[model samples]
Target: MALSLCLPLLAVLLQPAASLYNCSSQYERTPDNSDIIVECGTHTITLEINLCTAQWAGFNASNLALNGNHNNTQCQGSVDDSVDPPIIRYQLPVNNSQDNPCRQSLQIVDEAPDPSGPFSSFSSIQSVIITGYVDTPRSDVGLISYSTDLYYHFSCRYPLEYLINNTEIVASSVSVATSENNGTFIDTLKMGVYNDSDHIYPLVVPSTGLELRTRIFVEVKAVNLTGNFHLLLDHCFATPTPYNMSQSEQHNFFTGCSVEDRTTMTNNGLSTVARFNFEAFRFVQHRDRAKSSIYLHCILRLCEPTNCQVLLSSCNARRKRSLSPFGEETNDSATVSVGPLYTAREDVPNAAAYSNNVAPGKDDVDVAGLVVGMVFGSAAAALLVLGGWFVLKKYYWVGGRSQAFE
Candidate 1:
């Protein structure tokens, strides 16, 4: 009986030495299998078999770093192998003003690819917005033209289609001689979510996850001699085809995606400064669904002066690859007065002409106050100098007449 009790205690002690911490090591168990084993000195313990099978079954990270070891990351690649055509839309700056080509600029608000919430999708048409301001009464203004290259991060798995027979990634090209033209282009790359039955799509790693950035170059020019023209630009997320766009839906997808100039020319030619403030949102309908709209609360109004020179003429243009998670603000208003105008010494310069056509009686009080202050300051300074000179004369002269004062 004592021997049996000692045997049980010895077994317990041996068990701990054989499998104390229960940790495993990576070791090949078979031709297609692996095993994790634990060892303590001469004792061997089988901890687990095929432990990482589940993780590698899907695109999973070996660890949290997503190093492609487990093949868990979605593939990153282009949407197609060819370039799509360009689309252009125009809104004149002023009614009845001579039409000019509209200018455009593209700004990428997000680099993450596809399913940018409900407000974004996987189409080249979904990536650009067209917005501009109208010139007022005097309509001679420049034609606005916009062109940009879409920069993308290439995934070995899902390479984007190129422009010329799969030779490049430039989308369609467009040019408008004037802003009166209108056209539409829509192309979709059925990402994992929007894939149609036509093409064999590959698994794509999210472009955002890779932290890629894209930009569009835009230019706005003065085509004519119009100076009082104010130009603004904005964008709307392209409506997904086969998807009905409602009034609310239109408002939803374009959330916070507008920009405008912040100053204007008043009737008197003085520039009225403007401020641009905006907000953006991700509008949803089905809560978990991947389709929604973006909305931009855009107001292009005048603001207070920010600098000495008033706003003459302002224009804003932007092109972005990513949807605006939040819209942008631009201070494009310029000084319109052509020359300096004087209203009782107040230099009121015209932003457009820089000429002085001062309004009478407006700045007279200020000028008079300035003059009074200057006169008082000059008198005080003169008195001080005179007093100092007299004191110096007395101190240097010993005998009033000062002939060496001996």
Candidate 2:
């Protein structure tokens, strides 16, 4: 009974020390590129510190770990002070690796995620934040309290951003048509419009434009392609006619970049599916024209399990430089078209244009009906003006006669 009581008391006393253990440096230094070199692998991550360089940064370089298991001596690396430069190296698995406790450093979290993906991870190239601590805490850090730690940290990044030379990057974009050229046809893709944000309700647009400023939720998907790949869109726009280079256009997104303020590129290169939303708009040239139609077109490509996410981000960086298409160029991009949709008025959504209940008398207002209503309204206005003039004339004449009698 005495031994059990003592054991519980001992655990309580040691809990704080164990919890407080962290690899904070002896002193803080301004972040620099030469601080440490990092290597990110397919399933593992390696961190190396130079003894000569770390000494100037005041790194504490002690009590390093490679795995959570205390007995996993194969992973635990050595720290030697007697060496000339005193190099320290640690190799461990990434957080998402199959080995649950094998990773003792480098915790990665996704910055971009896809909800409906077949793979265990939503995207091949996901934005992630990798964090790890090096060395034990010391009093020289200037903070006396245990609530704070001065461990080394870096901002969120893509897995392929600093990958170990295993993947190739061929990220280039140019304007191209997604139609048949030289008898080449691309039938591996599909594009559609949805009525809800969840993308569950398919929206069937009119044969011509849609309502002004209605949220046009769109989704572009890859069909028969296999393996891990991401969809990269070069351009998507609304043209007054079938997509020819010779017409006024409103860009929903250009090169995976949003041009309109309300346009949201919710998912790009995140999975096999790419989703975006834009407000419905009529072409400036066709705003006053009735019976006009709008056509939607997009040019997109598929990226293998490499740095596609980073590639899309690069497109966003130079968005302003490539706004207009100078000429047509061709690559692996596929073109898909939707719509010949027309908008009737602000009151009607145009989806109700061709319903079974829409009889000729209820929905169709011919030119004759409009002309008769205008003629009646104009005649009524003229009669009201004549009556007002007669009343004023009679009142003034009566007043003058009364004054003469007085």
Candidate 3:
């Protein structure tokens, strides 16, 4: 009886330990008689078997699936091709969701030639799943549409982090147009972002003095804004001819020629649209020139509503005076004023005379005529004053003699 009890104890000790995981597998055959099998468990793996040679190719960690309701996090994965039948390993965080995590589905395509001979053809596609525990957070904003008059349009959705209530979003665009052939020709304009797609303008060609203007528009929408929020645009300026030359040379060539504007929006939600306008001018010498293109770089930002006011005040306080083409001093605020280049006249005496008359340069004839008129008028006034004084003296003398006789 003691011997029997010892035998039972030995059997219990010799029994194998329980497995940490279990695996499930499925298989399918290709038309060419190759077998493709997919297996899933704690680790997903796939295998392709050649029926003729009994050889096999395999892949591990091919796809991953994650639970839908998991905390937002970013995960990284890398492919190890150095090993036979390459594998992709995902480094998931330890705190990721255990049940129903997000997953990656992989499609494996076999394009390898048949080992039997070149005369035979065989191909197959197999899909495998590997569970992962990562979550992608929803974006706070989306870029609906961005269109150009040149018929180029780009639109997409991008995530905005740290978005909060009662905040402001601002977009400032500064586009500089530079000549591709020569570095001298350039023009830049800035304005409050807008969505007016019908505005057609001109950009000046520095070489030929021709106008060539292109407008830029920007629209912004708040994904899910709440409370008292605002959308503002500020501090937008463009350097049209930012030539590759020295700073002084560029300043002299441009001569403070620029356009600027500011706009604000107080509405809530995605209805708030802020549009920006920019006109670019590049100088190309050839009249029937080859195709030329303009490059524009812009920046868009978001901040608190109170921050917008502070920025606006700072910009205003730093304002400087700029000279216009007409030699008049104007306020260099973030505003643009468009006006006629020259005054029109009904009569034309002669080509040269009309040109001289309308020219902005000072005229010697006008200065001489004004001076002569002033001298003659002054002499005539002096003579009239002397005559009036003589008449008064005679009347006074006669009256004095009469008083003496009395």
Query: Candidate 1 lDDT, tens digit per residue, 1-406?
Result: 9999999998886664333222233311221222111111101111122223212221111222111112322211112112121111112222122332322222212233334322233232111222222111222355652322111111011111111110011222233112122211111110011111221332122322111111111111122212332222223222211222133343322222322222111121123221222122223342343322221221111112231113223212323632342212221111110101001111235544223555545567668999999999999999999999999988877556666555
- Per-residue lDDT of candidate 3, residues 187-242 (tens digit): 11222232255423232223333234434343333333321233333222222222
lDDT of 2: 0.50
The better-scoring model by lDDT among 2 and 3 is: 2
Task: Give the Cα lDDT of each candidate.
Answer: 0.25, 0.50, 0.29
The residue-level lDDT of candidate 2 at 120 comes to: 16
RMSD of 1: 31.7
Candidate 2, residues 190-209, lDDT tens digits: the string is 67777789988777666454
Find the candidate with the highest lDDT and give its number: 2
Best TM-score among the predictions, by candidate number = 2
The Cα RMSD in angstroms, rounded to one decimal, for candidate 3 relative to the true structure is 23.3
